[model samples]
Target chain A: MAKIFIIDDDEQLLRMVSLMLERGGHSTRLISNPVEGLQAVKEDKPDLLVLDVMMPGMSGHDIARDIRANKGLENLPILILTARAQEIDRETALKSGANDYLSKPVTSQELIEKVDELLSQPNQKMMPDRGVIIGMFGLRGGVGQTTLAVNLASALRRISQQEVCLVDFSPSGGQVALHLRLQLRHSWLDLPPLADLDWLALKGNLTLHPSGLRLLAAPQVPQLATEPSPEMAAKVIDLLQKQSAFMVIDVPRLFGPAFMAMMERVDIALHVLTPDVISVQTAVQLNRLLEKSNLKFKQKSYILNQVQVDSQIPQATVEKGLNARVASKINFDPNQARALSQGVPLTLTSAKSPLATMMNRMAEVINNRVAKRSGD
Target chain B: MGATHFGRNQLIHMDMFTDAYRVTGRVLVGAGGIHAELANPSSSFLELKDAYISRIHQPGEIVTHYKVAAFSKDNINFIVLQDRREGIPVGTQHGRSIYTRGRALSVFLTVPSFEISGEIMHDGKVAPREILVQSVGRYQLVFSAKALASLYPQISYSGDLILVQKDRIGIFCLDG
Candidate 1:
């Protein structure tokens, strides 16, 4: 049973609605005045609020807007019940932060159904329990960024029974679908407009991989001009966060809208760099760019990917050049290229490989950090 | 049961009480209005009057206010507007009134019969039952006639058919 608050000016209607809800197995509080209702909501914080659109002084829309603005009651589900019964009125009620709207003289059955629908929605208050987004960033290509991202995501999926999502935000087309060998008839390009993308749309666009990872592959034919905007990328991340327990994003080298958007929401950014002069120089510039742009991450870990066995630059030299300590060193593995050629992640095919073991350990560290953040 | 009180003050004797019709889902009425209730099924046909229908209906709305208006086990009626006043006035030719009034119109209707198959709850037990329900666009449960016929076959229905609302409807799917 849930606690429901009904705020309507009509005393008789309030009594009727309360009686109806109580019979429906919910504990309800009735407040006729909108001001008192707001105060009561702040004090009690009911799970659901049934508001009336037209009131004596304060309208339901204003009350809903105020409640939404309040940090404490931001996640409260609000249903607007009104006598106005106009298209504009319903739109305004939703615009003012109502989850749903219904006209007055609603039958008892309709009221309960709407209430059930609103309460059944996943509450924003439980968002901390949702997935954490980990982004892989490489200032320059060929640093084994996609390799790390794929293995990390696969490792995370293996570590937890929860769902994992891998998104490719590469402007030059992502290799996630190819690496996973996922045959896809659709990509993010097939999705409806960003404004119209919902859970179903997002789910429909994803291609399921055999490794139990959901992949939002990059466009088969890269279109930089038609790439998702920053806001669109943020919305996709937000939507994906709701469905998966861990999201591993393979971001492109460019710091454009999509890359920056993913950077903004990433809980942890793994800065992948090779032990090479050019890569180290690019990492330093990227770090400086992050500092100047104020695109903050909860945690940033510098990962040194030694793609070559005999490296000209040493780990110490790379660290000194980047001005950051290397958090993890991924040794060059000869089987990595073979694994990529076979369209399988090294972590999946060679779980006992040294590179896979290191990736799994990194995944564990990231998981622990996410758990600690959520607990806090 | 002797006397039962419903709503706030309405009361009726057990003998006079008719089988209750329960609304199973949120049925959209007019544009934004919703009609959901539990009450005795209408004895006769449900009427769509100017006053009750006006509250939910709006002018220039895409969805018709009274399409597939009444449903019975035998047939469903589609309301086709014959004439509507366009809010225009004309000078009297020879003392006879010649003006167009608003909000009044005639409709041509045809009742097409259909078969419905579904289940209902009786005495806390779900059983498969088939009854003819009227396809009224007003309520979510369009099985108006069949719902009444299956639930209360003995009760003589009179006046407008009342839609029976149920609290624990196990399965109420309309197949025609």
Candidate 2:
């Protein structure tokens, strides 16, 4: 029998669902408050999560996104049970990262069947002992580094069916949390000094995304310019690697101890650039710096992003100037702005778009590299 | 690619705008070229940005310049530079010539199995062996014998794999 956690604001419906699940020989835990339910799920690590779309404080959609964002609970099967039965609602529920969507007033048989189906599906394999670290960095702003980081994490979660943690290392205002529209109850700022941080302390500071990607967001406000020291950053990354299958870090433009620390641990550093003279120039400089630095990584690649419709430089020009082939090129899509504004990633908003397709392709490449590393 | 004409009477609404241009009306540019025209111009020139244009333009040259354009949330109309010079109607070019936003590449893979190095029930006796346990085809737990042999030479296992029935396992440390 699987342990199922159900979160709904309706007390009567909650009890009814508990009874139905219990009748199916499944142990059920009910929570009327979405926030409490989130905490309980983290601690309990249930087999399945039955979420309601419309909650008072936190909607089921947001809750699902949050649960998906946690590395520890990335693979938890979620069945969305809500009263809003519109086709669009169901679509939104699934897009928000719910495994299954079931309308409210579900018959006991229907509920049981759906739950059984979800439970019967193959559970994601546990994370390997070692994890792969991927760092996304761009010297120039608006090169789509944060967007790539968020979508890459989402794509990795989808392709690998594994836990992927996205750490926002931007010094100023990082947009990782903003892109996902995650409300920050906790952030890296909450952690005590690096000397005092442990697994528990570090884990508590992460904000979960519903895309099955955990985020370590930058401080909402820049205070004292407080950032992790190199040693502390390494320790945190090591800990995150232990907990997750892959850690995708969004490194800020600033070159500092923390950035160097991340670079040292990263398996691959994706130096993001756009088809612009300034972006290409910065990338060339960054490449030279990486070559000269003592820090080492398994692989270093350049990703050409088409952030703007107008290009000031051609890909060939960029390749020739940098002396490195562009490993990947992401096409420009108008829907990206909409997705960003709506706080949903384009990968989920328009999966078939060329942009999403390219992101998925990149995720596949990373997965293969990780598998190769594991085999070795 | 040549300019293709859209329906003459069709009025599409465009709502998104960039610093250089404003998009009005829904124009679906497919892989194949279509014939279309902008009924009006919001500005004096329409500059198109796309892979082809970016490749062809000189370092400082403006790409896809047009004259007499009008833009609104519901509609866009413009005249191409060539058409305005020749007093001919502007037409649609290849879809590839249109400027659009750029994206980033990502990769994903199947979740890997946990490697546990600990004691498991072997022949009803507790023994230490390093094994990789993965849930396959629902909830069946399978152990890798090769992993065990490589890590623990003392334990001899004949098969390359072992299916651990729920009751056949004993105490084990996941991280060990």
Candidate 3:
């Protein structure tokens, strides 16, 4: 059950609302004073908040605005319940940063519905200051590796409103840039040597999308593109970390020194795999090597990108072979065909489709895991 | 026995309104209902746990809260109840009905700062004054009651039961 925080001046209403929510299998913290309520919200973070409008010293709108301004509480879902049912009142409450607004005398069903809906949503959080680097790789192509990288990058940017960069670390002919519909005007090839490179010179290499996502594209022609040495890669990363809150790299289909260095740099290493015998076997080998070798990076994670609708190996079989749990599944979204054609990530679409929801949730899961790891 | 009938505690949130202030909190009620406990002639004060006190006019803001509080029953105009049977005495509740078929009549009454409307169940003739004059207890039970602020009708409460003090009623009207 989700812990819900309720702040209202009317004790009768507070009692009613708490009882209603509790009936729906939710635990509640009822505070009649907005001042104490705000303090309680900060001290004990609840899944959702039900705030009343006309409190004495502090109004619900004022409390909601304060919560939005707070660093960590910005994403806390707030549902404002007020006696003022006017359109202007609702507009003002929403403007005050409440997620949803309901008028007074709310029925049990309506209150429960609003609470449940808000709880289901992913209240995205700001990534930590140092930021997280996520590298996506698959030993073979058509495994949705680039798709995961692109969607994760888009999700992180849209949800957190933070700087996210998708890097096409593929040595040649990478599709990361194409996936986001960016013209191949500039790639990592544009950058000079580590010492000669300044901030502007490196910045010029990134292709910025209209959605505010940046991309370090691979050169369209492999012959023209020179893979940066390990030291150069590290320098570029050092610069990118200063600007980007999250850097999602689409690693190539090889385990070269440069690639291994990229793997070592990532906070999370995701190996995208399809539900196939070959994919599972390759993931097992890669995961074991990542743990056993000198490169002993703790990224034995596998993301099941179900590219095939059916005629596939069972997920249980795949997990058994890999000897690790599938971190998350990117179910076979039929919309992928359109998302790919349009160069828009499935997560970028505004529609609440199954595939989009899955992608967004996967992004959130990956982000939370990184945050937890960082805390540790 | 006391252990079998009164040992268990029912923790409920209730609002008790006096002529001057509104006190709200969780109250622990035994087998004997809250009305029975409050109306008991022997006890002069009703105990409230986690009490919040607010002036009648500024109902939303809390002036103070106490770990424990006691209110003199003489000051309370009415107490809003979530359970209607809690408004009724322990022995006279549901299964052990004394009235064959009590007629439900709409009634309106006024306290200091608020006006309340609800239904009253009685076995006698539909007389507004008789319900109060003939009642042996000091507090009367009003079921499915709504208390509206006299100045701000928008600020209103609909409770399952409003245990009203007969002496505090400034005006009483029964709809026949």
lDDT tens readout by residue for model 1, B1-176? 11112222221110001122211111212211112111114423322221112111121111212222322311212111101110111123464222211121121111112112222112211222322122222322221122212432332212112222222233444322
How high is each candidate's TM-score? 0.44, 0.45, 0.49
Clashes of each: 24, 45, 0
TM-score of chain B of each: 0.19, 0.17, 0.86
Residues A1-376, candidate 1: write the lDDT tens digits.
6899999977998999999999867899999989999999999999899998656567677799899889978668898987544454565676777777887668897787677655644344433567888888987989989889999998888777569999986655678777777777778777788779899988999988877888888876656635668887899999999889899998877787677888888877789989888999888888888888888676677888888887879877887797765767778888888888898888777877757877886665456445534543
Cα lDDT of model 3 by residue, A17-89, tens digit: 9999999768999999889999999999988999987666777878998998887887788999975443445
Model with the higher TM-score, candidate 2 or 3: 3
Report residue B126 deviation for candidate 1 (angstroms).
68
lDDT of 2 at B100: 15
lDDT scores of the candidates, listed in order:
0.62, 0.62, 0.76
C-alpha lDDT (0 to 100) for residue A179 of candidate 1: 78
Model 2 docking category: incorrect
Stretches > 4 Å off in candidate 1: A1-128, A222-225, A368-376, B1-176
- Residue ranges of candidate 3 with Cα displaced over 4 Å: A1-129, A221-226, A298-300, A365-376, B1-176
